[model samples]
Target chain A: MNASTSQDRFCEELTALLPRLRRFARGLARDPADADDLCQQTVERALKSRQSWQDGTRLDAWVYRIMRNQWIDEVRARTRRSQTFTHEEEGANIGAPGDLAAENLVELGNVGRALARLPEEQREAVILVLVEGFAYKEAAEIIGVPQGTLTSRLGRGREALLRELGEIA
Target chain B: MTVSDDEFTAYVDGELTGAEAQRVAAAIAGDPALASRLEAQQRLRALLRGHLDPVAVEPVPESLTQMIAAAAAEDAERDMTDTKQHEPARVLDFAAARARRDDQVRAARPPRLTLPRWWGTGAAIAASLVLGLFFGMRVADDGASVTSGGALVASGMLAKGLDEKLASANEPGKLRILTSFRREDGNYCRVYDAGASSGIACKDAQGWILQRTVANGAPERGAYRQAGSAAGELMAAAQTMAIGEPLDAAQERAARREKWNK
Candidate 1:
């Protein structure tokens, strides 16, 4: 394919990857707005660095790596401040109408709260392996960690998550 | 022998293989405690997935899809630089000629530098100027719009064009104004035919926030009247966002006189 066509194909494929990428971002950011911002920034960087991405390799992994780095390097600190500025005050305003809706809210709340309690490292490890369904090694490479480190992080994260779920249940 | 927590976690993730996996399997089968731990591990994964996966099903924000469209439009334009539209091998050869013609050719070409039309409010100009001064990447002269305080704000000449130009004026600049109308929420929105892309920006509290920009399949250079698929899409978007027919020359001129105030 020509360069432009190839790039167009890349963008097309990248567009297809958005929904899953947003889910992974939500796992990392724990805030919906910040997660969306993270997704947009990731797509932007992915386009800018399109030449760098290997064609046959996994686009999801490559984009996830960009997002993980973008989060760690830049977005995390900035969004954390804004999340408090807007979302925290705005959070209590979310109204659940009935018992079932309230129950569902608490269930989601339990998951988010549980994920929040873990350190960022452990949180990502758990999200990558368990929630997003990456293998130990693939998740490791995406997060720029060794396989052993990822396994240990996942183990500890798994333990913590289990305890949190048990307490809430 | 007891499997370590890592081994157990890996087992739950099904990451283990061959004899190592067999050993973990054997251990879990023999050890009641290990079996329960494995079940708990499996349960945690299921729980997290149940609550979190729904986010994937939620509708994606239009901003994101638009950002992708904008990026695609950007690539289409950068790839455009010329009119003949060659095949792959020739496109590269053409790249060499393009490189000879202008220093900024190919992907290395910088973000937008000229204004076909608009300038920001003085404060908007000052904010982006200071922003450009420090950030370096968010340059002013090249781009018609730049992000300010996390929001998209029309910058430089484009902002000036948006504030003053009327569609009914009938003269075309490098960037042609497609239409100007009030949106459903009463914001004054203007569409511009920007070569490879068609963009619409609405005047807002932060200046003109580029509401939508979609890439036309190819840049016709000066063919403003011809509606390509991208133009069709951009017009459809404008149609959806607009409250009524686009303003006439008199209306546009008057809106300009009032400084586009709602």
Candidate 2:
């Protein structure tokens, strides 16, 4: 069919996937506002270039991939523009031992902080395999890595998270 | 028998086949250390899933559905606009309409594309058409019309300015057009364009609203060759434009509620 018609169809499909896409963005972004902004950006990009979308292909993966790329770009931009600062130095400290027992909320907060600290590759593997429930192969394809690579990243990510959360043996 | 990390991970993922899987299971059953490791892995997996799975399987949001429908309508308008500008004599094709609908669904979920490999070829053809239209329209006098020389000249500085300027305030060598309109929610949404780059910017009561930037040469190349390969990138950008469902007459009225500050 003609280009315009195809693009029209693409917009329809992309609109349908927004909620899931927003959720994925939220997971990656952590902050609701950032996630929503990212989701909006993802949708905007997908709609504008709907013609680039392959017919009969999964729009979720395509959108996720775009979100992933956008997230990475943001992180890179943040890193480039900002000065290096530790969590504590940045006013993100979770506090010490005496404060720990009373801090279930803080502990959960720590989980998010630790998750954020994991390497981007590892975090992606964890998000895809553990959160998204994608099969190993599917996760690998989405991340553009080998299945073995994804498995390894997931393993390392989990191990690191466990250590950070004080759950590791 | 003892299971290594790989064995345990595989077992947890249910990847081991036949005797090997059985072997891992038996090891986990009999060996405390192995079983403990398995438990730990399982717990970690569970926690991760607990946090993330909900996001994947969550009920699709209504806003998203509205956005998708509105996007579809917007694409139809864009198509109509293009057709009017480029091929006014031709009648709209019904098969093309159905195909466009199907294409929308397909483009919405790109991961599903791999399962049916045969559909890929058709997707590629459709993708080429989409990109061709986008680029063709970029060059053509309709739908965000851009003169070739004007676009090329605008590319160098505008692209950089949009990339750098986050706020609506004017910066050196930056062209910002701002318009305020009430959104469906009665909140204002703004739109802007960075003149140097072929990027559109919108803003509302909130600061810089939305910025959609496209590098000029890429569209030019795709337009001339009608290359299907470039369709993926083109489709991605198109989706970005799908942000606020195309401004409806009512929404446009709402949008006019606030004056845009460029």
Candidate 3:
């Protein structure tokens, strides 16, 4: 395929992936508005830099990596401005109405809240692995960490989350 | 021996191979606590998936698709235009000529004294004299009626230009405006951009001072039509004057509470 044609196909594929991307973004960003904004920014950056993509590779991994970088960039900008939001503050606005099962919704809300409590690295690992269903190697690649480190983060993150949600003794 | 949390996670993720998985299963089967812990991990995974599954199934917004399509179209146009402007042979010839010129200059003898250094010194003195003449003319023009010191002193057309023309907010695509009541270290800061450059200025006992300047891409000219143009420049000049770190969130909030009166 010509470069433009290939880029068009990539856009089509990315369009199909948007809902899942939004879910991953929502998982990371507790506020729905911020989550949508994050997803939009990621998609925009990906589309603008489509030349960087290699053919026959996993498109999902490429998109996720872009999203992760966008999130980190935003975090850095916010830090430069000295802005911070606590987990409680972040969670206060996220529970959507009438769309999800109540128990499941509450669990999701708790998970979102729990996610905010995690250190940045652990949260990223958990999001990529359990939430986004990336394989360990893919998750590690996306986060730019070793596979062993990713697993360790996931292990610690799950334990901490369980404790926070009162799921542990 | 019982399996650890990490081992259970590995097994659940299928990271453990043949014997390792079997050993973990055996341990789980034999140990009630281990079995419960394993179940808890399984439940957590299911819980997480259950909540996230709806999001996965949620329809992609139409607006996002449209935006990406538009961006792709724009990129294609840009690439086509670039290709038309630079034929391969012409580009190679241009590079070759530029390389020859550079080689000639390198081979040329150095002047007895460097022309740039001599010119730079002369230019510096001339610049100071011009500044003095301009200000002197201004004083004479105003009949010495206006004292050229303090906040009011920095309130003329030049000051206005410094405030309005030097900001990034006046730039086209990458306009940014920052306003802080007080920096984290307790100084006021404002940053703005114009065209290809952005600058930060700070306020102190000395007056508004320029701090840092950075040049990015060319800013949009259309931004000048906005009411914010002058304000943008003032903020840019303020950023140039900043001292210490820009205000932290808490300090900025406090400064805002005071209405930036300082």
Best by TM-score: 1
Candidate 2 docking: what grade? acceptable
In candidate 2 chain B, what residue range of length 10 has the lowest lDDT sum?
B112-121
Give the per-residue lDDT of model 2 (tens digit) for B1-262.
Answer: 5678788887887777999999989988898888877777677767665655566566665655666678777666556445434533553553465466556646643342321111222233334333333334443322233332222222354433433432223334434322222334444332333322243443433443333443333345444333222234433433343333333333343334433332
Q: Which candidate number maximizes lDDT?
A: 1
List the lowest-lDDT window of 10 residues for candidate 1 chain A.
A94-103
Instruction: Output the lDDT of residue B229, model 1.
Output: 36
lDDT agreement of model 1 with the native: 0.68
Ranking by TM-score: 1, 3, 2
Q: Rate the local accuracy (lDDT) of all candidates.
A: 0.68, 0.56, 0.59
Model 1: per-residue Cα lDDT over B42-76, one tens digit each: 77878888868999999988877887888788777
List model 3 lDDT by residue over B1-67, tens digit each: 8677678888877678889999999988999987887778777777777766777777777779898
Per-residue C-alpha lDDT of model 3 across residues A51-95, encoded as one tens digit per residue: 889977999999999888888787666554432443655534433
Which 10-residue window of candidate 3 chain A scores lowest in summed lDDT?
Answer: A93-102
